[model samples]
Target: MRVVLAEDNVLLSSGLKLLLNSQGFEVAAIAADACAFLAAVETHRPDVTIVDVRLPPSFRDEGIRAAAQARRDHPGLPVLVLSQYVEQEYAGRLLADTRGGIGYLLKDRVSRIAEFTDALRRVAGGGTAMDPEVIAQLLARGGDPVEALTAREREVLALMAEGHDNAGIARRLVITDNAVHKHIGNVFLKLGLSAGDSGHRRVRAVLAYLRRYGGNAPDATTPHH
Candidate 1:
């Protein structure tokens, strides 16, 4: 798969390019600044783009802006964003489009090469790939609005945010498929997401959960090597 990479850090970018190349992803373009990042996307129009949350010249949110702009310019383009911090507000913005091919993962995850590549492939295949840290942050914060949900219901919701399907969640929780569906239904009802079609309701439920509990705390797990 062709990939455009946007990262200001030279060492990390080189390492990433090598890693992705070894994994059979063509590094179509590499950009060090926001302008170049946008240019690369328009020029290369790669299969997917991996970008950092910060870039040169002020280094605030240049990469996020580029990602948002790219989506506007090329709708449904797959992109995976990496960040050193959780920055839930940034995550919310990244997920706003929800065009099916998106990812928000902590940079530490790069050390787990297998999982990182899997996430990239998943996003490229039109699926979401959210970091475990992101989910841990949400859970660390109080889920008061969703507190009315039973423990299992909350578990289902969390797993959903982690990009797990009903079957995956069921297996992880060691429960029946029917039980998983029932918990998901209860979650939707408690979260007031039952009004829309199933797909729309699922998005609403996930967004509501994030808006409520995200941006609370640092991830509890040690940064992976």
Candidate 2:
């Protein structure tokens, strides 16, 4: 895979370039600011992009905005945002696009090579990979619809949002695959996502969870596909 990375920190960007290269991913370009980052996206058209939440010029949300703009300009472009904080609002905005091929992970996750690379690949392959911390934060702010879930069902839904499949969720939660399926079914039922719903039911469930944070919610009646 090819990557265009955007991070203001020289040490982190350089280290990431090396790490990605060593992991068999080509580093197409690295940008320190949003302008350069967008330019690189247009220039490299890389398979994926790793962006920081903040960038130069403002350091508030320049990177996130640039990432959103890049996605707008190049629809379905996979993006993985690295942030020092959870920034649930920003995360919600990005995820609201709901095109799949998205990720939001804490900066510290980069040190865990296996996890980071897996997330990168998952996003690149048109899947979601939200940080567990992000998911926890969203879940903590319980409200209508989501509040209907049992504690175990909520746990399963959280893992599903993190790009885990049934087997993976089972392994992580130390539960049986049958039990995982049961919980997921209950999550779908509680969320009002029927089996006949158009998009991947798991994706829709995650989207419903994300809708509580902010951004336009996916049309539950329409097929995400």
Candidate 3:
């Protein structure tokens, strides 16, 4: 995938550029700050953008905010937000705007070159690759909104958040479609939400799940994954 690299740290940025280059990804442009990063995206329109969550000037949520802006400007564009820590708030914000081709993980996780490249490829292909640490942290923060759900229902909810629909969730879980539907209903009931509330409830459930896991929103630097 064609990629735009954004990071305030020059040394790490260059190393990552070289690594991705060797892996056959074209480093379309490199930027040391959020403004330049946006400009690079406009100029290159890369298939994927791997950006550090912090950047020049204020060095705060500029990168995360920029990533969200890029998604808004270019729907379906793949964006992998690399951070030093897990920020549940940032992740929630990203998901609230769009669910396609987005990722959030710690920067150190990139040291496993093959895994990182594979994640990039996945996002470029229109899939999500959230850091397990982020997921785990989010899961630990608060009470599972679906905690009252039965085991099967919880299973369905987990798969659903993973972007699996009823059919897919059923198939993966080796259950019949009828069973999946039943579990889904149970989930909705347990969460005390109605049919028309699916979308809102889904987002709420996710947010709740993140909170239950002791996850905090994005700070300037989150040491999550």
Question: Using lDDT as the measure, which candidate wins?
Answer: 2
lDDT of 2 by residue, 1-225 (tens): 999999989999999999999999999999999999999999999999999999998899998999999999999999999999999788888767778889999999999999999999999998899888777775664357766677778778778878788888888888899999998888788777765655555876678656743422222211011
Model 3 lDDT on a 0 to 1 scale: 0.72
Per-residue lDDT of candidate 3, residues 1-225 (tens digit): 799989989889899999999999999999999999999999999999998888889888999988888878888779989999887777766655445677777889899998788778877877666675665455443354535656556555555554445676667778899998787777667666564555334434544444444443221112112
Candidates ranked by TM-score, best first? 2, 1, 3
**TM-score, per-candidate, Cα-based:** 0.85, 0.91, 0.71
Q: For candidate 3, which ten residues in a row score worst on lDDT?
A: 216-225
Cα lDDT, all candidates: 0.78, 0.83, 0.72
Residues 15-58, candidate 1, lDDT per residue (tens digit)?
99999999999999999998998899899888999989988899
Give the top-scoring candidate (TM-score): 2
> What TM-score does candidate 2 reach?
0.91
Better of 1 and 2 by lDDT: 2
Q: For residue 91, what is the lDDT in candidate 1?
A: 84
Off by over 4 Å in 3: 149-225
List where candidate 1 sits over 4 angstroms from the true fold. 195-204, 208-225
User: Lowest-scoring 10 consecutive residues by lDDT in candidate 2?
Assistant: 216-225
